[model samples]
Target: MADSSCGPRPLPPDDLALLSGLQPHDVRKVAESKIQAYRAMIEDINGYIIQLSTIQNTTVPLHASLPPEILMHVFRHILPTGPSDLRLTHVCKLWRDLIFRTPEFWVDMLAISAVTAHLDHNTDSPLSFPSFVVRSSPLPFELDLHRGALDFLRTIPSHVSRIHSLSLHLPLGSDYAAYLTALFNLDMPLLETMRCSTYATAWPIGLTDSTTHRVPDGQKFPRLRKLAFCGPGLPTRAFAFPSLRELKFDDGMFSEPLGPLMDFLESCAQLEVLEMNIQSPARQFRTERDAVSLPHLKIFSLLLDAPEGLWAYDFLEQVIVPATAQMNITWLAGSDHPLRYLIPTSPLSLSVEAIQVIHTLTIRFNYDRTVRDDSKWILSVNGFVPSHSQPYLKLTIHCPCWTLEEDVRPSDALSDLSGLFTCAPSLQKVKLRLDHGITVTPDHWFVILNSFPSLSSLTVRIGSCRSLLTVLRRNPTRWPALRRLSISCRNGSGVHECLLSAIERRAREGSRLEYIAFSGSPRRRLSEHRMRRLEGLVDEVTTVNEVEFCGMH
Candidate 1:
């Protein structure tokens, strides 16, 4: 009755009875499974925590370790004047603050704008003006200002006091007078170095008169050490630099007397190095009436125009040699005269030790189209015997000219070289500049190489690839002690192939070839496979030392 009273209710199984049937050991096993699962999960989480802890302890604290001073120094080294450099400061507030605070960093300035439009429009007038002025403050150091930015230059005088070094590239047709006036007004007391390059064609009318005004006595750069000037129509007005040690002038268009030039140099009695390139064709420079003395003149270079009949022998014998007895003269004879004219016929009578003391002698033959015959001039320095008592003479010749058809044979030039080697037993190195179209035969090079057993280096310049390969294939044995052998030819016409072949031959012969340089048209490209093959045969291949293509043709 109870069961049927409510509509057939289902009966619940007795849970206590079911529990009683389970063994205690089985219950423990079920509990142990649950515990193991919990432990595994806890271990997994702990492992993750340990790994994070290790990373936190070992990782670098970059921001904390970097000092502000180090960052500032790095920024100073990298931040120079330019659109790119200026933008770096805007990357962060720290950079902007650091850059703006350091005034010394902005002192050394470079004004390289060639057009007034960009500088006048983009530059901050007050900031740019003060930055340049600060460099010339306290004491001037160095300032390099490009031409065409005349608008900006007007501000230079305001900051001229801090300038110690000044390099100006004045444009043609600019207001040079105004620029000079501003420059002369500066009180550059500590100025040491000055270089000026003027475009003669650009000067406005009456610019020379304004530029020639005497640099005021009080404003003179008494501490100046080096000075260089280049332009046409330089003033003959004399100036002085008592502390000057070096002076260079590239006045290729000077038609005035050497008096003013010499007078300026004479004021710098302590000058140790002097380089003058007066392009006047007249060799009528009158020697100093008084006893000329440049006791400290250790280095001297002259680029003077040689008179038609007058060789440099008289100048060297009477003036240069005696004045520069202790000097190491590097004469760049850029004239059409023969090399023999420069040397004294009395070298035999001169002391060998005195001649051997010559540290460097460079003879750059003139390549003017006006002079028709441009062959290899024979230079004989005979009489100095190569013995244990005397070492070989060191001579370097630079000939940048095409070989005339008559001077095509290397033997003809080699004969003169042989004679030169015979005369100067101390001839250690011979640098020949051959015509690009002319080929130097190996047989001819052999004769010259045979003459100098003591020759340590040989630099043969071939104008054509065919000729260089011809020489290398023929005379591999002539350069026995040749530590350096350089072959430079026109880049086109398979010249690199010739070089590789020569390198391979040298490798087979167990010869040591140190350096190989190539010069030619830019259109020529040496294949990578060919270069790798060449590298296997030699130590190095350098394409950077390019031969200059210079000719009227």
Candidate 2:
């Protein structure tokens, strides 16, 4: 408070006198120490001056002031995963430095297409493949090599040890056996996933060697866990995969017998998810080999697109899925078996370990053009646990014809459904949706409704509601437990007469429906008189658009 001015204080007189009495050497030492102190003071002052100038003349960015660790985290959060992340280097010097130092941003940033484009001088990429491989450093990385990237494929063997995932998108007839053999010969200690797909094309032409990928006799993938292989056969023989947890095989042109493939699967007992989609599966299994048991399997999907006899069922009989797994099988319907016999004559025909009781059933008949623009009907049967959106058991039958008069008759389909009802005696709900030009007779509806003794809800959406309403009108006590009923007509035909008669008959028999929902196109909405009549019959009546009704149900 005495003198608030900015300046150095003078040394006390006694201290100055002590310095004046020093000898020559002492004086020199004291001078050097004082010089060092003054120089440090001057340097601090210069720093202050610079800081003040910066505050006054320029703005300091907030990011520049942030610590490097925080900046790295921010950069990772804002950056994309692939080559797009490299654009951050152009933002500023701090960002560039942070991105360069952080290895995670460069891990998944390498794509063969971009790298080869740079190699071929096709584009001026910011970072070359070699640069990324170096900048990513010792951390594990994912690699993607598409068809015709043999130049990069040649470089894979050098870096295969550190790869976490490798995906090779070979086209129909790729000839990368030498490169693939070279890559597989090396041990991938860090590899967790490997996918070799032909992009849904034909299989490869030749094997790596006469037998398998000359993979050093006993070479194995020590840490490999997930594998998705699609081709005529696996690239390697019974090479051990002790850590494999997920496996998927999708080969549309698999022509080999089941013996070799089954022998390969017998080694992977720890698999949790297995999916096999082969257009034509092997019809016979080696009699000496027992069913392959997957104790830890959580999801199993087998799609046999062959339009032959029960190959899907035969494949299921060869795999022993645990009771806890969810299963889906899509089999093409053959011309010999009726629609009812397309599935196993009984659920016992499937592996006992794979069967789960059905509580809810959904059958949908819709037209599809998947088979070369032909008119086909896809009958998808989905069974689910209560309150579950994902089906536990899904069976799909693909038929070449779409109408009742065609390859499949509605009565035969109902008879097949009745057989399914025998399997699920406790079935509580059923939903049937038929597209246009497919109509069932009232007798078929009568048989199907009487089969579900415990069905509490029934929803029907067809071309016409005449058969269903007539079935209900004839007998009100058929489905004694059906409390909810929803009906929609595709043609939007006037259903008021038949619908009112059905509801009146049910009411007269003391079988009152708790909820009734009727839907059709907007052009065929129920008139005011019909709406009042329906509301008076049912406790809760809803008149919705056909689209909204389907969505809500």
Candidate 3:
């Protein structure tokens, strides 16, 4: 009989006949032969695997030719804790092994929330927080958590000391006191940088919330060098950062009493860079304390939006910096208050002796009465030391104008412009750009021009060139020290005639220009005919292309 294990299917006619004629011994022998063939096939497969393994071990791939250290160094250029790093581990078996062994590749541990996934496009399955911490071993690593920051910190209490940098991004409308308390309670001895930000509408813990959850006393980050707080938060109080050198606060308004803010600044005595953008409240009650002294501060930037009044000036009176420090102050105030109020005729916060000898001054005045909004007027002043590539001081003031007057009085414009240059007595180079919306008579321009008696070089832009030419034609002896003149215009149609007339008139008066250059758009370039005319009146004449002229500005 056929084996019952073969199931109910009937065998082929010839196979059935052969099986009937064969004895039991013949069937057993056939089965033994089939078993031997299967063994031989398994052996062949095993040998093939061994041969392939031997080849892989003996032959080196192109990437494997380099030393493991060099390859790891190249991988460092790729992003640390993202899909890019995950791809490196899957390139080949050799690379996979090397990436797993190298601890530097796993030094940045990140946990991202769905809302902030755009900040870190990491969706790899292998990046568990604990796995990263263990894989990174004893080396210092950075921790970036976009959400669930407080809970994550709870699970890794022991690993806080190894954190090199920590960044936390909190959701909008969430209470920030818990986050701050969690941060203050921890001890981060090796931490070098810490950044905490939120999307809250206002500071989470304001003056009203000061009574709740006070920052623990005697807490400090000893090695912290950089601290940044964005969005809004409670006042910094009762914390010490002896080595902190840089601090930044953006989009925050200090609560009514400025005492807490002052106390926080007093702790960071060695700060080198301090930047803040806060809104100042109206009622200016002078904080009854000595100015916070930041002698080591090299870059100080303060931006304020005070609609009720010019509280920025009053606030700045409490802070003192070095005379050589660079300052950039921007204030947005009501139209009734002039820039002269914010930047007084006498130096308010800046040292008088340091600003008295500035060499280069750039004045950019833009105003449009037609648009009755807060951005209708902006006055920008930049001062530079002759040898320095960076400006030592920059002051910009914005005001809202409700008036629709097409023309303003000449004296009104002169008063505002003259009061600005009182501190720049030693200025030798001036770049003046005025918007077309502002209208002024030639006499006003002449008065403004004569204020810089020591100015030897002048650059005029746009419609301001017409007023300058009129001033030069009206009074050839206006700016006696002016020798070099550069004029840039949007259109050069009737500008050539004005330039020729002014230069010829100035030459006839014996105060000949030493050099003159005219630049405009490609389609509006001065004709060669007019270029020759200007060349005769001045010692040297040049026409600058549009691309080159924009850089000069």
Please report the candidate that would top lDDT against the real structure: 2
Worst 10 residues of 2 by lDDT: 115-124
lDDT of each: 0.50, 0.68, 0.66
Per-residue CA lDDT of model 3 for 43-118, tens digit only, reads 9999998678655843676554777778777765555544454676666666766776666666642432332233
Candidate with the larger lDDT of 1 and 3:
3
Q: Which pairs of residues collide in model 2?
A: none
Ranking by TM-score: 3, 2, 1
Measured against the true structure, the TM-scores of the candidates, in listed sequence, are 0.48, 0.65, 0.66
**What's the CA RMSD of model 1 in angstroms?**
23.1
Better of 1 and 2 by TM-score: 2
Count of residue pairs whose backbone atoms collide, per candidate = 23, 0, 0
TM-score, model 2 to reference? 0.65
For candidate 2, write residues 1-553 as lDDT tens digits: 3354867677668557758978999988877887798799999999998668655532456744666798788765553544554677876555677788777777746533454344332223446565676567778887766655445645545666777887776533354555555555666788788887655434455542324433233234677888887765453443336577888887647564555556556776788988887776544566676788888898988777666545665665677777567888776643334544444536666533422456788888776545443236677877777666787777776763433345557555655556555555557888998877678888788777776778889988888888889889989877778889998886554777888899988888888898988887677677899889888989999988877878855
Residues 396-420 of candidate 1 have per-residue lDDT tens digits of 2223121323233333443443533
